[model samples]
Target: MLFRQLEYLVALARERHFARAAQSCGVSQPSLSEAIRKLEEDFGVPLIQRGRRFDGLTAEGERVVVWARQILADRDALRGEVDAMRTGLSGRIRIGTVPSAATAVPRLIDPLCTRHPLLTAQVMADLASTDVLAMLREFSIDAALTYLDDDVRAAFRVVPLYREKYVLLTDAAWAPVRGESVSWAEAAALPLCLLTTAMRGRRTMDAFFAEEGAEPVARVETDSFASLIAHVVPGRWAGIVPLAWIHALGVPPGVRAVPMADTSPAPEIGLVACRREPESVTVQALLAAAREVDLRPLELLPRMRMPGPDRTRGSGQVGP
Candidate 1:
């Protein structure tokens, strides 16, 4: 019933324990446990299974946890709206972006941070589309930079931001590509290092490969997109990557991003947020900012180079 109690429930769902969840919420274990009990009493059903240690949530508890997230997100939105009315706009915003967007992040985050000095900004690197949805659902993330198919993500708020197509980045040896497009069977024959099967991007590639009834070889397999860019240089190896990343990440000098013809593989990447609730200022700013970027296909330019400053290896691995 109470939002704070719902917060406790969400926290418990995340941490799966009272003491840890309470610590995260900055409350004592008993107080937090009591809140959960009260919520169960209010609902007339046990939310959590109790034992010497925290077992798990009941079926009712699992359902309530989803409601709790939605309710909490609504509360935060309401608070943000009221606060915005009073003050010029000050609130923390959490964002989850795909690894392919690494180069675009600084361009986005720097301007936002500059515009709102009082606001806190947290940027997380996310690689999986499912994880992106989960974070948005749990209110752990305000918005995610990803693309979703209707079946995969029909419930959330989606804004079409950019449609990034895949490009084959190869070392200089293969330049002035033979055809207007390349096929998966042909692509498979070329020496290529690709992202592991874990990444959605990789899976997307695999699907394309499957369509051609061919599988590409990965002499070098990495979870890092940057590593994919790094490994496929002009002289030796090749990789398949999003064109946006080439410009965003400033591809290595030896690498060349050649658009795969015959196979026009384009995935719609966008800003995904919870349509169920009003967005926070930071989240709103992100949406506004995303609209500002007039992103187009990277290979449109006949000749271009990766210009952005290279970034340090991200501390977090791409989560599925």
Candidate 2:
């Protein structure tokens, strides 16, 4: 069957309507319908459940849609490989990441883009650890930056970035902690604005607190670090954030990112990508750039000071 027929099937599965799917594909409804019919005839199975209106895909259709997505993705990767060979790697590399690791995307992109002037990078953020795996399977993202958990390490090719260290970001008025660290229990007692449970960072924090025989009840829950910082900057609440964030995105006035005393083994954040034979040039460039980065020195640096002009946040490229 033609690739266009598979494209039409995927579009129908996504849009769930004939006219709308046709509109998205920039084709007439009758044309799209005819294409779908032809696809079913070729496959010798009904792809869609028929009625006066669009119902849904049959079991066979659903399976075909899955294969169609994979075929399309592989086709695009093939084209990208050819383009990279003819004219250097020159396509967008979509990088999905956990919220906490969002700030570090530039460190990876700077070197890659510098090497390939034609390359562009898109960073998606605030994704759960589970979602990162799902997006990779669906080819929704080229790579993911997240904690290097066992399942991820086992399934994909990974590049270790750095171990994430936790710190309690609090207002000076509430807890004046400078050049000193605080224990988890003490921080838990203070009014807090925390990342929502959906965030992997929040889950880590919760596990730490649970071990201390206490549960953290946040006064405010948000998935965005910017939102957490906004609440903490007002001098009434605190947030538990990664030290990587403090170094990458400086804290605002009245907020101090004090190191937590708990010295358990922290999770390592890394880049995860699909393990394909003859990997795409875009992914290869990213791996090469990752090897060049030295996060060891940054990890050894002292806690970040209050925000300043030189300590500006990232370019706001991180997704929600």
Candidate 3:
């Protein structure tokens, strides 16, 4: 079948609407349909379940769609590789990241872009770790910045970036004495705002609480770290966030971040890419960039003295 026909089939599978699929492909509805019909003739199978409106794909169509995605991804990779060999890496690298890694992803992308100025980075943050992996499997993203668990390690090629450490973020009025670390039990006792249960970071935090025999209930739950931070800033609720978050996005005035006293080993976060036979050049470049990232700033976050109430908002400076 022609590549154009495969493109139409994939678009139809994604949009699930004949008109919309044609619109997305920048072709008329009849043209898209004719292409699909021709593709079916070539394959000798019915790809789509026919109806007046758009029906679901046939079992054969479903299988073809999977192959289509892989073929398209490989085709793009070939183009990217040729372009990079002639010029520099000049295409968009779509990245999917969990919200907790918001601060760390930049360390990977910034260097990649600096080295390859023609490359563009598209970051989709606030996804759950599981969702990030799913997107990577579906070829929706070029790479992922997420927790490196056993499943991830087994499934993808992982380049460990940094271990994520937790901290308690709250208004200074509600914070512990300066330089004092907060325990899981102590953090759970506070009126806390946390990520929703859907997020892997929240699940990790919940496990920590379980280990401490503390089942602290959240006063507020949200999927967005920004929303959780907003709740903590009000002085009525505290939040558990990655220490790297404070280093990346400093707290506003009147807010303080206390290191978590838990001795449990932190979870490792990493750059994950599919283990295809011929990986995309952009993905390879990203892996190289990830290896060269300076994680010392994050490593020092726990030992550094966090700013006190007197410190200026968003200064991200260590106190003496």
Report how far off residue 201 is in candidate 1 (Å): 0.8
Better of 2 and 3 by TM-score: 3
* TM-scores for every candidate against the unseen true structure: 0.81, 0.87, 0.91
* Candidate 2: tens digits of C-alpha lDDT, residues 1-320: 48999999988888899999999999999999999999999999999999998899999998998888888778878888899889988989999998888888888999899999999999888888899988887777889998898988999999999888777777654534544677777778888899888778888888778777767789999988878888877777888877677677665665556677765677889999999876777888899899889775445424443346666333221111
lDDT of 1 at 239: 77
CA shift at 18, candidate 1, in angstroms? 3.0
TM-score of 1: 0.81
Total backbone collisions for each predicted model: 6, 0, 0
Cα lDDT listed for each candidate: 0.73, 0.81, 0.85
Candidate with top lDDT is: 3
Give the winner by lDDT: 1 or 2: 2
Off by over 4 Å in 1: 105-117, 152-154, 174-183, 233-236, 277-282, 297-320
When sorted by lDDT, best at the front, the candidate numbers are 3, 2, 1
Error of 3 at 226 (Å): 0.7
Candidate 1 pairs with clashing backbones: 171-233, 171-234, 172-234, 181-261, 182-261, 234-254
